[model samples]
Target chain A: MNRQELVNLIREKQSYLCVGLDTDIHKIPKHLLSHPDPIFAFNKAIIDATRDLCVAYKINTAFYECMGIRGWESLQRTVDYIPSGIFTIADAKRGDIGNTATQYAKTFFETYRFDAVTVAPYMGKDSVEPFLAFSEKWAIVLGLTSNEGSKDFQMQRVGEGYLYEKVLKTTMEWGTPDNLMFVIGATQTAQLGEIRKLVPHHFFLVPGVGAQGGSLKDISAVAMNADCGLLVNASRAVIYAGNGEDFAQDARRAAQEYQQEMAAYLAEKLAVKQ
Target chain B: MNRQELVNLIREKQSYLCVGLDTDIHKIPKHLLSHPDPIFAFNKAIIDATRDLCVAYKINTAFYECMGIRGWESLQRTVDYIPSGIFTIADAKRGDIGNTATQYAKTFFETYRFDAVTVAPYMGKDSVEPFLAFSEKWAIVLGLTSNEGSKDFQMQRVGEGYLYEKVLKTTMEWGTPDNLMFVIGATQTAQLGEIRKLVPHHFFLVPGVGAQGGSLKDISAVAMNADCGLLVNASRAVIYAGNGEDFAQDARRAAQEYQQEMAAYLAEKLAVKQ
Candidate 1:
């Protein structure tokens, strides 16, 4: 999905939740294990339960990749099953040399048909530029990540500012708000407002909200723009809310709760009408 | 393979050359496209011809990942085809949150069965440490990359030294030299000596030779340790040496050239008998 479509989605749904299918086979309800593809079955249920409540679906590629070829089949099915017009992100934190990045760009955008792919900016501009080349496809590069390890390099000072600050400022020069975005972890709410002001027009794919102990209210308060320039992701919180036969229903409840709260935030922050 | 096995392999072979199987479908000999699995067929020929010449085979996962499920099948087949003694690397460059990193480690080490997987260190210690969790497996984290874009973040000074240096030093606390390695690009010859001094025992997987314009002699002179701690990689130069019917033979000849140069460097730097 392009920038305008995504903004319209948040406006239309009054929610910017990107339900993550970071679906691990071991974590799913036991009853679904008998199915030919439990991962997809689980994801299908989650998508069905939450489709109307959210505007995006982010697939954690690692969860699928660890299963080998069968996992890929599950992934293919899951992506195909998601109702289109909603933004889709291949949360595959891929980065490499120039030519290699192009292949990754193809993997998510052309092959799997994700609307965006998460990229690591460690390899710098060329590593990220390939993902931005595709029209309507976005490259959501890592800014300040939620994990503690962000302190190791990203949070460290580079010249006058943090490495992530440098990342945000310099990376903005490479692409516009139309094709470029940043993955600003919800844990970095302290920096979120400044980050939003720093990169005013660009969107941010905000993870680390639900299961990772990040406050949804805090991040939304600081990061929302005129266009509701934030896609707050909640993975485990919604998908693994229940373990019984009513798991999908429980998931829907969890998603609706997030969407309801998000609607309130949208109305309060961007004056986005429900 | 563990550190000792890798060291012994380098010593026994009298070469630390890493044959990069960055097999691109469009670039492979058209005759091989008629095979049941063209990518695997091409990789098999290259492996058969260069088995004894190089101590490691680095598979650029992006090349295979772009082909979708069939690409993954080819990757499985090619890795299975490689001889047991040689180290195998999945040059995936994946990094994410702690749990996500664990899944990537499993993707390359457990599922794909590569001895080592290259990791991007942008997410910090939690991202890299999981790859080090597996016994006898390796996480070759990016220290400094070969691309011009490396100047963007990696070469930028952080605190007392470069960001990549902070990465090298801080990351050392998370894993032992036995399980840790760094991808030190050949283009950074000016820092090669200092980097070797900074990191004496750990191995460096050097890319950017040949097609990327890196000097084998320059890196070998400054970076070689007592154990000859370098696995210099030449991907396209070795894989696409010739695109005709005799491509494998051409590839073997290219690998032999790198091996021969590496053998001379091993003898000169480490004073090991070849």
Candidate 2:
């Protein structure tokens, strides 16, 4: 999953949206809740419905983990459901000691077959380097998060620049933009320019746009690089749009709207490139 | 599970040791590898041998995750095998958006019944606070990691302190020391004095002391507070001590050595207090 290939996928699909599979059995439609495997059933329909509208699928492992064994099965099934061409993310937030991280890379890359796994760079290089060692795999390190706590550490003034800026500058040495990306919160629209200055070429997996009150237009305008360099993820705003039997269809409709918006953003980007 | 209770337990056991159950089925003894569930069998023996010696068990999720369903089952069984008095940690370094973080909290605290879980604080407060919200449960945020990469971001100069110092100072307000702990790499013995200044009251779960070449004596001297405020974790150096059939006994011996060293550290702390 190189930068050029990701950009090409977005251009080919005319969409930069990444639908998040944060599916919970209890949160799905009541009619399907009685199904033997509600989480997988919901994920299957969601993927089927929105597969054409998006370029990627982000699976948050926490929702599936709550159901224990059943949740894990749902995760494996959902990963299998997603098309190979589309980027698949295991939003596992994994980072550990070097050897431990090597094992984690093997689990997400070999055992589960995810294209990328979200990594926390707080542990520095050893925790993140193992993930980058794998071919075609990415280490999406957290930059400025959209949460209220973003002010706690990421935005705190560290030396001359913000802590996140320092992280971006230092971690750049670990891997190239091709094998590394940054998770810049969509809500931190004001910081995008500063973030871009730190890592101008790297892809930013921008979350907090839909349900978390971040504007897509603001994010796209401020963050996009020469490449259509953003995978704006909308989880609850898409998947849980309607908790009734039409949940999947509603999800598709929400995804289509995001895709349509992304198409315009990328089109403007291409127009600039031309 | 509360603060004082945990402190008392650490005192009564005369051990601040937390044996990390980073059990890889492939790394287990050949005799156990032939069992119906190798990881579980190995873990069960380890638990049986060391339950009385250690006050806590830290289950690093990656080892279990690699085994898939059977690994998860082993994790659950391992959690069950530990006696009620000991603390349990799902060393699953999880952090995400608010809603998703709530699910992670539910999974580890509610589903798996873990007393604590490691979290990467890079995503800011929202990613970590949800984990901290649970009563008696902990969010062990990564402070100074024991890896080559620690030189990258964590140790980077930020203001008058390091970036990790900022993380410790800022995030400390989000949760009380009772429910908040920091993962200070045992290898960073020299910086423990400064780290102690930043997070004096909170418990520190220090790793990298054994196979990673960190000094236990140095860590205890600089990091310990009034509460014997440290849980020194040794994974490979303890769990994988021997690959032969006597692996569990070897593990016990290694753990006993750590316990004895920790007892010496505690005695020093008591002397300092007196």
What would the TM-scores of all predictions be? Answer: 0.98, 0.95
Please state the error at residue B127 of candidate 2 in Å.
Answer: 2.1
Q: Model 2, which residues run further than 4 Å from truth?
A: A1-4, A272-274, B271-274
Question: How does model 2 do on interface RMSD, in angstroms?
Answer: 1.5
Chain A TM-score for predicted structure 1: 0.98
User: Residue-wise lDDT of candidate 1 within B1-274, one digit each (tens)?
Assistant: 8888999999888889898999999999999989999999999999999899999999999999999999999999999999998999999999987888999989999898999999999999889988989999999999998899999999999978998999999888889889999999898899989999999999999999999999999999999888888999988999899999999899999999988888888878776433
Lowest summed lDDT across 10 adjacent residues in model 2 chain A is found at A149-158
Clashing pairs in 2: A125-B149, A159-B159
- Top candidate when judged by TM-score against the true structure: 1
Tens digits of per-residue lDDT for model 1 on A1-274? Answer: 7788888889889999989999998999999999999999999999999999999999999999999999999999999999998899999989986789999999999999999999999989999999889999999999999988888889998878899999999999999999999999898788989998899989999999889988989998888888988899999999999999999999999999999999999988775443
- Evaluated at residue B18, the lDDT of candidate 2 is 90
- Scored by lDDT, the top model is 1
> In model 2, what lDDT does residue A209 have?
73
lDDT (Cα atoms) of all candidates against the true structure:
0.92, 0.86
Provide the lowest-lDDT 10-residue window in model 2 chain B.
Answer: B25-34
Model 1 CAPRI quality: high
Please estimate how well model 2 matches the true structure, expressed as its whole-model Cα lDDT: 0.86
